[model samples]
Target: MSEANTALSDERIKNTSRLRTALIRPELGGICGTIIVFALFLIFAGDSGMFNSQGVMNWSIVSAQFMIIAVGACMLMIAGEFDLSVGSMIGFAGMMIAIFTVTLEWPVWQAILVTFALCIAIGALSGYIVVRTGLPSFIVTLAFLFILRGFTIYLPQLIERRTIIGGIDDAAEGDWLAGLFGGKIFGGLFQWLGDNGIIATFERGTRAGDPVVDGIPMLIVWAIGLVIVGHFILVRTRFGNWIFAAGGDAQAARYTGVPVNRVKILMFMFTAFCATVFATCQVMEFGSAGADRGLLKEFEAIIAVVIGGALLTGGYGSVIGAALGALIFGVVQQGLFFAGVESSLFRVFLGLILLFAVILNTYIRRLITGER
Candidate 1:
């Protein structure tokens, strides 16, 4: 009887392991999505510039914003918290930077420092409320989203009686910021792409094709660097283990001396820091971050993280997967444009993709938790 039981146990363990291997492989799903996207473009808009040089750069330039924010949101989600106010935070930080640098005539670095300090305070307050009250992060962050959003538009409008804030002095006018954040330097890379004879149609075969211009936007590089750093902290270090433990079972982690509250605080701070970085990028891209600079951006970040295979309930996710998910997102958006789909209708398509991603994520999640 004992021998028979041991054999059954071993069989079950093997099955469980196999299930995990599949569930954790979101990068595989990402590859499938890539193929699907590429094929759709080829069939529907084969004549579009998507196969060209400059057309490729368009998406890379646009996607840097989404990819960077998505990477940070992924880390926060994996740590078992959420930040709905990120979009508002962006506008607020940008507006504040303008106010300090332009309206108040402060130096750029000083304005940035103040903005960082403010973001940290807000993050700390949010974390304190969530951890102490045991309220849902959704509810707490939802309130913040509204408060910050209102302040962003109304405060400026109340003072100026207009929705826009212009006429401010350009405190730092040497074009240094733009050169660093918005320039391109991959002439050699684009030459390599065309020489490969892989595909060409869009861009008029324009020269700036490497899919990332200005020598790979500073923001994307920062996001990638963050991924490496976050991955290191999560896997090669002790803090990562604690994050998994805390998210997996808060009560148990506390009993194990995991410093759960401190972790929660730090996660919030990380998100706020990301918001500040996003604001800086927006300024570099547009020369200004308006009161309405980042509308619905927070939702987009959350969607990217979820699509990257993070669990809705927390405890499992991959930063690299989220980065890949962001790439898929950028491609689809640009693909629709290249394929001649109405730009206004792109959101509906995005909604469908998110739905599909979530469904896949949920099913895989069920298999892992033994609920399916």
Candidate 2:
């Protein structure tokens, strides 16, 4: 009887240990939070068809837009930095693309290539300044934020006397490079579904044969591709290790032979590259750019990263978690409309979620690290 009791006790101890380990995973908090938000929205918004094909596509598309920058922001945060200028960078890039292609009549591809190169240079410059000055990134990026935002507004007005730039769609017409970046894929599958009644079609309209659900948007494809690549780099590559080490302890990382400064500079450039990609996608989809485009996006990207279980101080995070965080934002942002809540109230919801997520994440980190 004593032997049997002892065996049962040992099994219980092993089970408890396994449960604790699972609970302490960095992404577990994000996963649970996403599920809860999804469930709540589903219960309240089911009749609004948020789970339907069209609704799914709508939210997923918006989420992809957020995820691209959020992934970059997550990586940067992991390496102990911030870029408040990302939102302005988007606006600037969009405007540059428009001016290059429309006002100057440069080829769309050339304009795009030039814009990307310039963006990288800007990022590298910012990183260099931060490293050389030993200044906090918040202050440095804040300055760039205003500078870039001012340029985005002033440059267009000075040249064209207006804040909006158009004609991109016309320039992209028949351009294979533009099509590659902005074009949709899997037309046959959607067409077949629409034809065979597997997917819904427009009812009683001139476009009656068109499928309500077309091919997946390019933005979503890019988001997923980047997320996978980011996850791989973070989890399975040497650079990822360098990123964590740099953020965790810059001095120690340098002492240990890591190129901390180079890693950070590259991360900064990568973040800028992501912002440009987002700008490219939006400009392509809408066929225009505006000075006010991408406003406040920097905060949203950071919020997504924080909600993804990445610490603000750096050194701990997961790209998959950031993706999930974007998903939660998408669900809430769209779900609120479906649930008939006022759009203005969404900020309140975000504030509350961010607060709670920070608290939960902090507690979980402590548990995992065995800190009081």
Q: Number of the top candidate by lDDT? A: 2
TM-score of each: 0.84, 0.94
lDDT of 2 by residue, 1-372 (tens): 788776655544434476678767668867998999888987899879888878888899989998999999999999999999999999999999999998999998888889999998898888888988989888898898998899999999999889999989999888766775687889789989899998778887888899998898788889999999999999899999999998988999999999999999999999999999999888988898899998999999999998899989888899999999998998899989989999999999999989988998888778767799
Q: Model 2 clash tally?
A: 0
Clashing pairs in 2: none
Candidate 1 clashing pairs, residues 3+ apart or interchain: 49-202, 51-201, 52-202, 183-214, 184-214, 185-215, 203-206
Off by over 4 Å in 2: 1-16
TM-score of 1: 0.84
lDDT of 1 at 336: 84
Query: Best candidate per TM-score, number?
Result: 2
**lDDT of all predictions:** 0.74, 0.90
Question: For candidate 2, what is the TM-score?
Answer: 0.94
How far out, in Å, is residue 338 in model 1? Answer: 1.4
